[model samples]
Target: MPYKARVYVTLRASVLDPAGTAVQKAIQEQMNVEIQSVRIGKFIEIFLDSPDQTKAHQTIQQICEQFLANPVIEDFCFELDEIPRVSNLASQG
Candidate 1:
């Protein structure tokens, strides 16, 4: 079976995000809304083939911790789902 995983990486609350601050300023100026703050993050989607759900979960965790996210400043999380194969007839109908 094949699986799709979505990973989200976000900067820690203590870390400052200049880009996000800039966007917040722009929004406040343009919309005249009293927005307190804004934070930016990254989203990543990965598709892989794995039969063992347990192993897949562990692998995703490692990937996020080791490569996808920066432990020093960023935090990460992921969601995994199995892809359901569609038959030809299902598509035609």
Candidate 2:
């Protein structure tokens, strides 16, 4: 079975996000809505073919730590779901 993963990468709380701050400032000035805080992050989607759930999770974790997100300043998490394989006959009307 194949699994789909959604990964989110965000700056750690200890790190400062200048882009988020700028967006917040702009919103306050233009819309008159004061936001205490804002944070920007990245979303990534990946599909993998693996029958074992544990192996899939471990692989994704390694990928996140090694390539997807920086471990030092960024924090990452992911959610996985099994995609049901549909046959061509099912799509034919």
Candidate with top TM-score is 2
lDDT of each: 0.93, 0.94
Question: Tens-digit lDDT track for model 1 on 30-50?
Answer: 999999999999999999888
> Candidate 2: global Cα-lDDT?
0.94
Which candidate leads in lDDT? Answer: 2
Alpha carbon RMSD to native, model 2: 1.3
User: Candidate 2 versus the native: TM-score?
Assistant: 0.92
Q: Write the per-residue lDDT of candidate 2 for residues 1-93, one digit (tens) a residue.
A: 899999999999999999999999999999998699999999999999987888999999999999989989999999988888898998895
